[model samples]
Target: MSKIVLARVDSRLIHGQVVTKWLQQSAANEIIVVSDELEQDEFLQSIYLMAAPPGVEVIIKGTESVKAYWENEAAAKNSKVLFLVPDLTTLREMVEAGVVKEAIQVGGLGGGPSRKNVVKNINLSEDDVEILEGLLAKNMEVYFQAIPEETPVPIHKLIEKYKTL
Candidate 1:
C-alpha cells in the first residue's frame, strides 16, 4: 500500500528545498501537491511537474481529488507519497477531510501585512495560529523547520512566542 511519508505545508510548493532535502529525507517517490488554484492552471501544473527530479513523479490535485485518491488508489500503489499543501488553511481542510492525519512540516509561509515573522522564512497570521493549534489539539505533530538540518520548532513553542510578539 502507498503511504504518505511526509505531509508538508509550504507557500512555495515545489521548490529547491523540497526537491533537494525533504524528498530525499522522506524517501518519497511520488509528490502529491494538493492545491485548488494550481490544479486549475495547466501551464503552471506542467511547470511544477517538470520541476521535480527526473525519476520522481509529481501529481497536482485539488483538495477533494486528493482526499478521494488517498481513500482509493493511494492504498493500492507501492509508491511512497510526499504530500504538499500550500497553506495552513489548506492543510487544516485536508486534515479535516482525513487526507493528512499525523505529522506536518511547515517550511515556508509568505510574509504579509497582517502576518508576523515567527522564524526566518516562516510567518503566521492569527488564523494560521488557530489552525495549527487545532491540529495540535488533535494530537498531530506540527513543526516549523526549513530543511532537514535545521532544528524543528514545535507548535507549542511557536504559539508561545507568537503570543509574546
Candidate 2:
C-alpha cells in the first residue's frame, strides 16, 4: 500500500523548497502532481519533470484522475507519495473524491491582490479558508509550515483568530 507522506497546497506548483526541503524530509522517491492544467500542458509538465532531481520520477495526472492512479501498480510500488495541488479547493475536491485522509501540510502561498488574509506565509482567501474548514471537519489535519521541521500552525486556531473578518 502507498503511504501519503506529504499533502501540500501551494500556489507555485513545485520549486526549490519542494526539491530540497520536502523531498528530503519525506524521503519521497516520486512526486505526483495532481493538476488539470499540468495534465494538459505537456510543456509545463516537462518543465516540472526537468526541474526535479534525476531518479525522482514526476508523474502528472489530472485532479480527477488521482483515484484511479492511486490504486494502480505504480502508486503501489512507491513507498512515499507526495500529493500536491495549487489551492485548498483542489485539496478538498480530492478528499471528496476519496483520496485517503491525511494531514495537509501547507507551504508557500504567494501574495496576490485578492489574497489579503495572511497567516504565517500562506495567504488564505475566504474560499480557501472554507475548504480548509471542511477538511478539518473531516478530521484531516491542516497546518502551515514552509519546511518539515518548522513549527506547525494549526489552521483551526488561525481561522478562529480571524473568522469574523
Candidate 3:
C-alpha cells in the first residue's frame, strides 16, 4: 500500500522549505496537494508543478476527489506521498472522509484580521482553534513546526496560550 509519509497544512502549498527540507526528511517521492481552489486553476497548478523538485511527482486534486484518488490501486502502490492541505478545515475533511488518518504537521497559516499568532509562523482564528480541538478529541496528532529541525509545538499548548485572546 502507498504510505502517507507526512500530512502538512501550509498556506504556501509548495515552496523552498517543502522541496528542500520536509520532502527530504519525510523521504516522500510524491506530493498530493488537496485544494478546492487550486484544483480548478491550471495556471497555479503549473506553478506548483514547476516548483516541485525534479524527481518528485505532484498532483493537485480537489478535496472531494481525494478519497476516490486514494482508493485507486495505482495510487496505493509504490508511492510515498506527502499530502498538503491549506488549512485545518481541509485537514478535518480529509480525516473525516478517511482519506487521512495520520499525524499532521501544521506549518505557516499566515495572519489575518481575526487570527492570532500561535507560533512564529502559525496564526489561528477561533474557527481554526475549534477545528484543531475537534481533531485533538478525535486522537489526531497535530503540531506546529516550521521546519524538520525545529521542535514541534503541540496544538493544545497553542490553544491554551490563545484561547483567551
Candidate 4:
C-alpha cells in the first residue's frame, strides 16, 4: 500500500515551492496530482509530469482515476507519495472518496474576486471558507502552510479570519 506523505492544495500545482521545498520537506519520492481538468490535456499533463526532480515520479490522474490507482497497490511501487490537488473542490472530492483522510496543506491560491488573502500565499473566497469549515466539522486537519519552515495556521483560525474579511 502507498502512504500519502502529504496532501496539498495549490493552484500552481508544480511550481518552484512544491518542487524544491515541499518535496524535500515531505521526503516524498512520488508526486500524484489529481485533477480532472489536467487529465484531459496531454500538453499540460506532460508539463507537470516533467516538473518533478529526477527519480521522483509524477503521476497525473483525475478524481475517480486516482481512487482506482490508490486501490491498486501494484500501480505504484513507491511507498511514500505526495498528493497534490488544484483547489478545495478537488480536495473535498478526494477526501469524500476515502483517498485523502488526514492532514491537508493549503499552499497557495491566486487572488480573485471575493478571494480574501487568508495567509501569506493562500487566498480563500466565501465558498472556500465554507468548504474548509465543512472539512473541519468532519475532523479533518486542514491548515495553511506555504512551506515546511513556517508554522501552519489551523483551519479554525483561517476561517475566523476569512469571516472577518
Candidate 5:
C-alpha cells in the first residue's frame, strides 16, 4: 500500500528545502498537499505545481478529498505520499477526520508572528510545542529537524528543555 512516506507542517508549503532536502531524503515521487486553501486557490495551486520537480506529481486536494482518495484502490498502490500542512491544527484535523495516519511527523515550521522561538534556527512557540506533545501523546513519532543532517531533537524532550523559556 502507498504509505505516507513523509508528513511535514511547513508554512511555506512548497519550497527549496522541501524539493531538495525532504523530498530527496524521503525519495517521495508524489507530493499530496492536503490544504483547503490550495484546493480553492488557483494561484496558490499553480505556484506549488510549478515549484515541485517536473517528474514528481503534485496533487493539491482538500482535506475531504484526501479522505476520499486514500480510501480508493488507486491510492492504495505502492507510492510515496507526502502530506504538507501549514500547521499542527490542520494535521490534527486530518487525524480527526479519519484520513490515514502518518508513520512520522516532521516540523519544517517557518518564521511568522504566530511562530517565534528560534529553537536551533527553527522557530517555534509554546502552542506549537503543546500541539507536538499532543500528537506524541497520541503515539505519533514527532521531531524537529531542519534538514536530515541536523540532530533530530525529540519534540517531548525539546518541550522539557524550553518549557520555562
Candidate 6:
C-alpha cells in the first residue's frame, strides 16, 4: 500500500508553503488533492498542476473516488503521497472512509464570519471545531502546524482558545 506521508487540511491546497516547505519536509513525491469542486473544474485543475514542482505529480480527485484511489495497487506501490483537503469536513470524510491513518496537520482555514483565528494563518468555524473534536475523540491526532519547522499545536488547545473568544 502507498504510504501517506502527510494528510494536511489547507484551504489553499497547493501553494508556496506546501510546495516549498511541506513537500520538501515530508519528502512527498506525489500530491493528491481531494476536492469535489476541483474535480469538476478542469481549468482550476490545470492551474494546480502547473503550480506543482516538475518532479512532483499532482492528482485531483473527488471525495467519493478517493477511497478507490487509495485502494489502487498502482498508486500504493508508486510513491509517497501528500494528501490535501480543503476543509475539516473533507478530512472527516476521508478519515471516516479509512483513507487517512496518520496524524492530520492543519495548515490554513482562512477567516470568515463564523470562523475564529486559532493560530497565525489558521482559522476554524464552529462546524470545523466539532468535526476536529470528533476526530480527536476517535483517538486521531489532529494539530495545527502551518509549516514543517513550527511546533504542532494540539487541536484541543486551539478549541480552548476559540471558546474563550
Top candidate by lDDT: 3
What lDDT does the true structure give each of the candidates?
0.90, 0.79, 0.91, 0.88, 0.76, 0.90
Clashing pairs in 1: none
For each candidate, give its TM-score against the true structure: 0.97, 0.90, 0.96, 0.94, 0.85, 0.96
Question: What would the per-residue lDDT of candidate 5 be over residues 65-97, giving only the tens digit for each residue?
Answer: 877877784356777877788777778778777
Candidate 6, lDDT over the whole model: 0.90
lDDT measured at residue 124 in model 2 versus the true structure, 0 to 100: 67
Off by over 4 Å in 6: 73-76
User: What are the runs in model 1 whose C-alpha is more than 4 Å off?
Assistant: none
The candidates, ranked best first by lDDT, are 3, 6, 1, 4, 2, 5
* TM-score ranking, high to low: 1, 3, 6, 4, 2, 5
What is the per-residue lDDT of model 6 for residues 16-98, given as tens digits with 9 covering 90 to 100? Answer: 99999999999999999999999999999999999999999898999988788888842547688999999999999999888
Residue lDDT tens for model 4, 7-114: 999999998999999988999888899889999999998888888889988889998888988989524575688899999999999999889987999988789987
Mark the 10 consecutive residues where model 4 has the least summed lDDT.
Answer: 73-82
Worst 10 residues of 6 by lDDT: 70-79
Displacement of residue 17 (Cα, Å) in model 6 is 0.7
Candidate 3 Cα misplacement greater than 4 A, ranges: 73-75
Instruction: Give per-residue lDDT, candidate 3, residue 133.
Output: 94
What clash count goes with each model? 0, 0, 0, 0, 0, 1
lDDT of 4: 0.88
**Worst 10 contiguous positions by lDDT, candidate 1:** 155-164
